[model samples]
Every structure is written in structure tokens, then in C-alpha cells.
Target: MGKITGFMEYERLEEGYRPVEERVKHYKEFVVGLTDEQAKIQGARCMDCGTPFCNNGCPINNIIPDFNDLVYRQDWESAIAVLHSTNNFPEFTGRICPAPCEAACTLNVNDDPVGIKSIEHAIIDKAWAEGWVRPQPARIKTGKRVAIVGSGPAGLAAAQQLARAGHDVTVFEKNNRIGGLLRYGIPDFKMEKWLIDRRVEQMQAEGVTFRTGVMVGALPSEGPAAKVTNDAKETVSPEQLLAEFDAVLLAGGAEQSRDLPVPGRELDGIHFAMEFLPQQNKVNAGDKIKKQIRADGKHVIVIGGGDTGSDCVGTSNRHGAASVTQFEVMPMPPAQENKALTWPYWPIKLRTSSSHEEGCQREFAISTKAFIGHKGKVTGLKTVQVEFKDGKLVEIPGTEKEWKADLVLLAMGFTNPVPTVLEAFGVEKDARGNAKATTDFIGGYATNVPKVFAAGDMRRGQSLVVWAIREGRQAARAVDEFLMGFSDLPR
Candidate 1:
């Protein structure tokens, strides 16, 4: 620890956001990162605990105490080195990760935990500014080829690891851009697209090939049509990929948005959160969407109380919606969790996102029964208040009500990955439709099919970006060991 008494002297400082009025006008990152001195103070809050639970709390197992100490001692270069040793992309996680590590912080037993995420954000930004972040190309070529599908956090992490291990790595993405959800599903207001672009540039310099707008599976003949990018006019098939590469890793995300099947579900103004989110992101990236879904002057009703639903609320508010309302089937969580009983573990506490702070009415213990519409357009939503009894949700007798809703967005999270892609490759899947694979000591990430591996949301179901990165890094080690009978990569 840089200063043993630092925690007692200085209070915790957090990153600030742009004023709501000013930021709502445009889609841009508004978080004001900490200054160098402020970050040092925050880093000094890390205690010299014999057991660092923060390490286990983090999905990527970041050496939190070491980096915090380095930052406190004003050692920017070493801090970034320690950070990159575990996380391939701290910028993404710093901005979006829920910071479970802080939940496990020893100081959090009573006082606010060390501002670990902000310190990480500061260290990486400083490293970039000082030109310390550079390409690390392999010293020798191994001549092993790897084909990675999907360019999300998982695929990108795996590609970087494999490329550094002297493998010929190529990443294929169906979308026009490299980042899967990070580029589209997440609103640009949370993180700018340029961050992803810079990482892609560094990866390319490190010998990783990126092929965007190249779908590595059979194109759907019918159903909801996919939005095509200007860069490509055609799609690639699974057979073409299998024939071209020595090994394939399926990191494609869980893209299938869970739908609300109810009366008037086919209404015109109702859509999935994925359908509503991507267009705005594309528009922010300077792409012209001809028929963009807008919430301007409409009463928006977002179903589901998760991150995706909050994103819908934010996007709607940005579009100048007349009003917005969000519904959660589960009851609202407690305002505060009993830390004495739930130390070092994630607790069930009410979370209100920045989007919720922007403006919106939130309802809990409520479920939508039907979509009231007219002339094939959604007009309102009929909902009922419910209570849980004996592990069953029972609707209250007289709590059914209808509310005006010109546009309805379903953001109830994804059910599973698109089965066609996995099925086409003949990979066995779990009961939930995720690719079947065991993360064991031997043959980790190996699917039933030889030379095929799976990771990320496609294998573990929909999960956080940090978890995806961990899975990708581990899968890379598994692939390397399988190829060379041994690997030096970290587990």
C-alpha cells in the first residue's frame, strides 16, 4: 500500500457525468474521468489485506491491489502493465462493468470502497496519452490458423491472445463493424465508438485480421430481415469458413431477443429492444438509417427492468419522448442490503441507472397482459399487478389497468443464441440452446465437434462483457494447449 492511513484521510471520489440537459442533445460519452492526482488519492484507499477478495470478485481476476498501489505511487506504466496482464480491454469494463470488485472491498464493510473502476479508467487513459499503449506482435510465427466468429469482447480477447501466441488469427463479424454488442447494443452516450476503433487498430497491428460484414453462417430466407451494411453485398456460409480455417471458435453473442407473446403482439409500433437500440448506434456512427424507430412525441412503454430496458428509457428520453414508463415483473429490491450478512458477495439491492435518473416512471411486480392497438399500431398496454405466493406469481383481482403507449419496446433479455449457426456447424448444444462445453482442466471450451470451440454468451448464455472476456482468454489457452500439446498462456 502506498499510504497506510490514506483511506482515513481522503474521501472517495467518483467519475461525474455531463449535465442531463446538455448531454441529452447528442449521443456522446459524458463521463468526466478523474484527474491524475484524484486517481492517486482514490488508489491510495486500497488496504493491504492479506486476502484480496476483490481479485476473486472481478471476472477477469484483475490484480486490483497491485494496480491500485502502482497508481497511488504515480507509476502509470506499471499500472497499465498490471491491468493489461489480466484484462484485454479495461476501457470497456471501466465504463460498463458493474464493479463487483468494489462490493468485495474490505473498506466497503462500512465506508465507501476504493474507487477502483475510476482509477482503472484513469490509468488506461493516461497510458494512452503518454503513448505507452502499443502493439505487441509475436516474436515468432507458429503457423497455426484460427477462425473466430463474432468480434465482441470474447472474440476480440481470444483473437488477441491467440495472435500473441503466434497463431494466424482472423475474426469474422456479421455486422459491418467489429464490436458486436459494444458497438451496437450499447448506446454511444455510454461509450464512444472510437474507443473500439483504436483497439481494433492495435489488434490489427499485432497481426489479427478483422473481416467485418462477413456472416459465417447460412443467411435466413425468411423472418425478420437483417439490416445490411454498406460495406458488403453478400454473406458467407458455414461450410466456406470450416474449409478455410484449421480451428473455429464460435463467440457469436446471444442475439435472439426474448419476445412478449400477447394479444396485439404483431402491432406496428411494438419492437424488440435489439431492434430499437442498434439503429441509434448506427446513426451515431454516421450511418443513415432510412426507417429509424423514433420515440419522439410518443408515450413509450419499455417492458423489462434490466440494463437493456434502461437503455430503451434513455434512448427514448434522448429522442424527446412525450413520456416513458418501465415495468418489472419482480418486486423492487431493498434500498440497502445487509452488508454484515452478504459481505464479499453480490447483494440484491435496488439499482437505478443513469437512464432512470434522466426521467421515467418505474413499476415493479407488474406484468403486461396484452397490447391494446388499433389499425395494426400499438395504442396502449394492459397490465396487471401481481404478488408472489408459494413460488408462483398470482395476479391481483382488481389491479388490471390499461395505459397509453404509442410505442412498446420488449427488453426482457435474450433467451439463447441463434440456433441456426450452431446447428449448421454440427455443434452439440445444452438444453438452453447454448453450445455444450465444459470449462475443465483438460479440453476446455472444446465442443462435441473436433477442432471446434465455443465461448462467451453463445456457450454460457447471455452474460456480462467482463465474463465474456474471461471466457475468451481461457478458451484461447485451451485452444493453444490443444494445438501444441502445451501452452504458456495463463489459465
Candidate 2:
């Protein structure tokens, strides 16, 4: 760790943010990073606990304490090395990760935890500015070709790792550009797309080839992905990929958005969160969109209370919606958590995102009964309050209500990967319809199809970006071992 008594002396300092008024005017990243001095102090706060649980808590198992200590000692280069050893994309995780590492910090048992994510952001930002981030191309080519379908975090990670391991890696993306969700699903206000471009450049320099506008396998349905960007100039069949590449990895994210199949579901004004969010992202990226979904001057009703719903609220506010209201089926959680009971675990407590603060009315324990529409377009919503009774949701009597809603966005969550892609590969699927792959230490990331592998959301379903990176890095190692009978890549 850092200073032995630093935990008692230094207070936890979070990163700053731009004023909401100025930030809402445009779609750009608003969170301010800590200065070098502030970051050093935060790093010093890491205590010398007998066991470092932050590593275990982090999905990628980053060497948190060592990096904190290195940063405290002003060894910026070594700090980044320690960070890059386990995690591939600290910048992405630094910006959006929920930071379970801080929750699992030993000092958090009784006091504020170390600012691990802030420190990581500082380290990587400094590394890039100081020209430390460079291509590490393999010295000797292994003469093996690997085709990774999807250019999201997982696919990018796997491609980078495999390329560095002396394999010829080519990433296939269906969209006009790479970065799958990072390029489309995510709003620019949360994370600028330039970050993805920078990494893509670095990956190219590292001998990783990227093929955009090339689709792999067949799309399951046009409805689920109608608003999604899939500007594929050509389609590559499963057999074509298998015959051309030594190995294949499916890292496409869980693309299907969960829907609300209630009355008036086919209404014109009702749309999935993906439909509304990606269009704005395209507009921000200078793409011409025709009849794009707009929330301007409309009463927007968003279903679901998770991050996606919050994103809808923020985007709607930016679009100058007349009113924005979010609904969550589950009961509202307490504002605070019992620290003693859940010190080392993700606690169940109220998590109001920055999007919510921008301005939106949030409703909890409310379930949508149907959409009220006029002229085949949504106009309002019908909902009833619900409560769990003996482990089952039961609607409360006489709590039904209707509220004006010109536009409705479904933001519940994704259930699984696109089934058609998996079916085309003939890969075994889990009960949840995700690509079936065991994550065991010896035989991890192996699908039923020979010479084919799966990782990230396609294998594990929707999850955090950090988890996807972990699966991708681990899957790269598995694929290397399968090809070479032994792998030198780190797990």
C-alpha cells in the first residue's frame, strides 16, 4: 500500500463534474479528472490490509494496491504497468465502471475506501499524455489467423491480446465503424467516441486488422434491430469464417432489448431504448438520420429504472422534453445501506445517476399495464402499483392510474445475444440463450463448435464493460492454449 497511516490522515476525494447547466447544452463527457496532486493523495489513502480484496472484487482482478502504492510514490510509469498487467482498458473502466473495487476495499469496512477508479483514470490519462501508450506488436509471427466477430470491448480485448501473442487477428464489425455498443448504444455525454477511436488506432498499430461493415452470420430479426446500425457492405457466412481463420471468437454484445408486451405495444410512439438512444448517437457522429426519434416538447415516459432508463431521462432532457418520468417495477430501495452488513459486497441502496439529477420524475414499484394511444401513436400510459407478496408480485387494488405520455421508451434490459448468430454457428446455447461456454480454469471460453470460441456478453449475457474485458482477455488465453497446446499470455 501507500503510507501506513494515510487512511487515517487523508479523506476520500471523488472526481469533480462540470455544472449541469453547461454540460446539458451539448453531448460531451462532463466528469472532470483529478489533478496529479489530488490523485497522489487519494492513492496514499490505500491501507496496508493483510488481504487486498479489491483485486478479487474487480472483474479483471487489477492489482489495485500496488498501483495505488506506485502512484503514491510518484512512479507513474510503474503504476500504469501494474494497472495494464491485469486490465486491458483502464480508461473505459475508469470512466464508466461502478467500481466494486472501492466497495471491497478493506478500509471501507469502517471508513471511506481508496479512490481506485479516480487513480486509474489519472494514471491512464497521464500515460497517454506522456506518450506512454504505444503499440506492442509481436516480434515473431505465429502464422495463425484468428477472426473475432464484434468490435466491442470484449472483441477488441481478445483481438489485441491474440495479436500481441503473435497471431494474425482480424476484427469483424457489422456497423460502419467499430466499437459496437461503445460506438452506438452509449451516449456521447457519458463517454466521448474519441476514446474508442484512439484505441482502435492503437490496435491497428499493434497488427490488429479491423473489417467494418462486414456482418457475421444472419440477423435474428429486423424488428429487434431495426433502429440499430448495421451498415454491412457484405455478409460473411459461418462456414466462410471457419474455413478462413484458425480460430473464431464471438464477442458481439447482447443486442436484443427487452420489451414490454402490453396493450398498444405496436403504437407508433413506443420504442425500445436502443431505438431512441442510438439515433442520437448517430446524429452526434454527424450521420444524417431521417425521421429520427425525438423527445422534444413531448411528455416522455420511460419504463425501467436501471442505467438505460436513466440514460433515456438525460437524453430526453437534452432534447427539451416537456416532461420526463421514469418507472421502475421494483420497490424503491433505501437511500443508504447498512455498512456493517454489506461492507464487502454490492449493497442494495438508492443509486440516483447524474442523468436523474438533470431533471426527471422517477416512480418505483409501478408496473405498466398498457399504452394508451390515439391514431396508432402512444399518447399516455396505464400503470398500477405493485408489491411483492410471498415472493410474487401482486398488484395493489385501486392503484391503477393513467398519465400523459407522448413518447414511451422501454429500458428494462437485455435477455440474451441474437439467436440467429448462434444458430448459424451451431454453437451450444445456455438456458438463457447465450453462447454456452465454461469459464473453468483449464477449459474456459470453449463453445461446442470446434475451432470456435465465445466470450463477453455473447457468452455471459449483458454485463459491465470491465467484465467483458476480463472474459475477452481470458478467452484469448484459452484460444492460444488450444492452438499452441500452451499459452504465455496472462490469465
Candidate 3:
């Protein structure tokens, strides 16, 4: 440990955020990163716990202690190296990732956990500023073509790894831009699109070819609708993709957003979070959208009390909505977790995000019974309060109610990847409908179809960006091993 008694000697330093009024006016990141000294102090807080659970707690299993030590020593370059050794995109995780590592810190047993996320954010930002981050183009060419379907974190990570391994990697994104959800579903206010563009530039230098606005394999043009990329300029059949590339990786994420099947779902003002979110991102990227969803002067009701719902709240506030109300079907968690009972793992506790702090009414243990409308448009919603009794949610006897809502955004998470893409490739699907691929120590991540693989949400269903990165990196290693008979890439 760089500082033997640092944990006892120093307190955790929190990151700063821009004033809400100032930040809400525009869609851009407002987090002010820790200073070098503050980062060193935060790093020093990493104690010499016998076992570094923080490392394992991370989805990517980042070398947390080593990077913490390096940052404490003021070796910023070495710190970034240690950080990047496991995390392909610290910039992404450092910003949006819920720091499970911090939750697992030994100090968190009683004291404030080491500010690992803030230190990570500081290290990466410093690396970029000092020109320490650069492209590591392959030293040798393998001449093997790998096709990556989707350009989200999983696809991007896999593409970068494979390309650096000297394989010819081509990433196909159905959207007009390279990043899938990162460039669209996520609000620029949380993380600006430039961060994605920066990584894309580096990936390009590493010999990864990006083919945006291209959909590989057939997709349904109608139905409840899934993975609708209105800007896909061209379509490549499954046969063409399989024949052209030596290997194909299905990295497209879970795009089938779970819907509210209640009546009045067909109302004009109701939309999936995916539908509303992408439009804002498109507009942020200078695309003038027709019939764009607007919350201005409208009472916006966001369902699903998760990160996506919080994002909707922020976006709606920025649009000057008359009011914002969020609903969660489950009972509200305690504001603080019982740490003694939930140490070394993610805790179940209430979390109020920065967007939630801006303004919004949050309703817990509430369920939407039906959407009420007149003249073929939504005007309000019928609701009921729910309670858990004997492990079952039963509506209370007399809590039925109705609330006015001019706009409704459903953010109840995704069900699975679009079926057409997997179906066209003849890949087997799991019971959950994700691409079926085991994470075995050997011959893993391979799909039923020969030379085809799947990773991230495409294989594991809806998950965090950090998990996606982990799957992508591991899948790349598996693909490399299958191709070159061995792989130096880390797990």
C-alpha cells in the first residue's frame, strides 16, 4: 500500500457537480472531477485489506488496489495503465457505472468507502489530458476478418480487442452513428457523445472498420417493434455476413423494451423509453427529427424508477415539462442499507440520482392499472397502490386512483435482443430469449451456429455497461483462441 495508514489518516472526498439550474439548461456532463491531490487522497484511502473484494466486485474485475496505489504515488501514467489493463473504457464506466467496487470496500463496513469511482474518473481524465491515451495498433496482421454486429460497449470492446490482436474487425451498427445505446439511448447530459467519438477514433486507428447505418440480417418491419433504427442505410443478409467474415459476434444489446400491455397502450402520448430517449440524443447530435416527443408544458409520467426513468425525468425537466412524476411498482427500499448484513456485495437501498435531485415526484409501491383517454389520446392513468404480503404483491382493497398525465414514458427495462437477428443466423436462444452461449473456461461464447459468437446483452439479457465490457473482452479472447489456437488477452 502506498500509504500504510492513509485509510485512518484521510477521509473520502466526493466529486462535485454543476449547479442544477445551470446544468439543466443544456445536455452535457456536469460532473467536476477530483483534483490530483484529492484523487491521491481518495486513492490513499484504499487500505491493505487482506482480500481486495473491490477488484472482484467490479464486473470487469479491475486491478483496483494496484491502480489506487499508483494514483497515490502520483504516477498518473502508470495508474491509467493499471486502470486500462482491465477496463477497456474507463471513461464510460468512470462516469455512469454504479460503483459496486466501492460498496464492497472493506472500509465500508463502518467508514466511508474509498472513493474508487472518483479516483478512476480523475485518472482517466488526467490520462486524456496528458496525452497518455493512444491507439495500440496491432504489431502484426492475422488477416482474419471478424464481423461484430452492434456498436454498443460490448461490440466496441470486442472490436477493439480483436483489432489489436491483428484481426480485421468490422463493426456494423444499424444506427447512423457508431455507438448503439451509448450514442442514442443515454442522455448527453450524463455523458457527452464526444467521449464515444474519442474512443471510435482510437479504435479506427487500431484497424477496426466501422460500418454505421447498416443492419446485418433481417428484422421485422412491423409488430410491437424492436431494434427500430430508422437510419439504417443498408441491409446485409445473414448469408452474406457469414460468408464474408471468418467469424461473427452477435453483440447487439437487448432491444426489446418490455411494454405495458394494459389497455390504452395504443394512445398517442405513450412511448417506450427507447423511443423518447433516442430522439433527444439524435436532436443533440444535430438531427432535426420529425414528430419528436416533447414534454414542454405537459405533465410527464415516467414509469419504472430505474436509471432510465431518472434520465427521462432529467430530459423532461430540460424540456420544461409542467411536472414530472415517477412510479415504481415495487416497495421503496430503505434510504440506507443495513451494511452489516450486505457488505462485499451490491446492497438493496434507495438511491436518488442527480436527476432525481433536480426535481420530480417519486411514487413507490404503485401500479398503473390502465391508461385513461378520450378522442384516441391519453389524458390520465388509473392506478392502484400495491403491498407485499406473504411474498406476493396484492393490490390494497381501496387504493384505486387516477392521475393526469399528458405524456408517459415506459422505462421498465428490456426483455431480449430483437429476435430477427438471432433467428436469421440460426443461433440457439436461451429460455430468456438471449443468444445461448456458455461462459466456459474453454470453447466458450460460441453460438450453436459455426463460427458465430454472442456477448453482452445479446447473450446475457439487459445488463450494465461494465458487464457488457467484461463480456466483450472475454468473448474476444475466446474468439482469438478459436482463431489463433491461443490467446494472450486477459479474462
lDDT of 2 at 168: 96
Candidates' C-alpha lDDT = 0.90, 0.91, 0.92
- Residue-wise C-alpha lDDT for candidate 1, range 214-268, written one tens digit per residue: 7777544533324222244457776777788778999988877787888889889
Off by over 4 Å in 1: 219-232
What is the total number of backbone clashes in candidate 3? Answer: 0
**How much RMSD separates candidate 3 from the native structure?**
1.0
Report clashes for each candidate as comma-separated counts. 0, 0, 0
Error at 70, model 1, angstroms: 0.7
Q: Please provide, for model 2 over 1-491, each residue's C-alpha lDDT reduced to its tens digit, 9 standing for 90 to 100.
A: 99899999999998988888998889999999999899889989998898999989899999999999999999999998889999888889999889999889998888888999999999999999999889999999999999999999999999999999999999999988889987787888988899999999999999999999998887856667444568898999999999999999999988888878898899999988988998999899899989999999999999999988998999999999999999999999999788889978888889989899889999999999999989888899899999999999999999999999999999999988878889999999999989999999888998999999999999999998999999999999999999889999999
Global lDDT for candidate 3? 0.92
Per-residue CA lDDT of model 3 for 178-197, tens digit only, reads 88887787899999999999
Candidate no. 2 TM-score: 0.98
Where's the lowest-lDDT run of ten residues in candidate 2? 220-229
Instruction: List the pairs of residues colliding in candidate 1.
Output: none
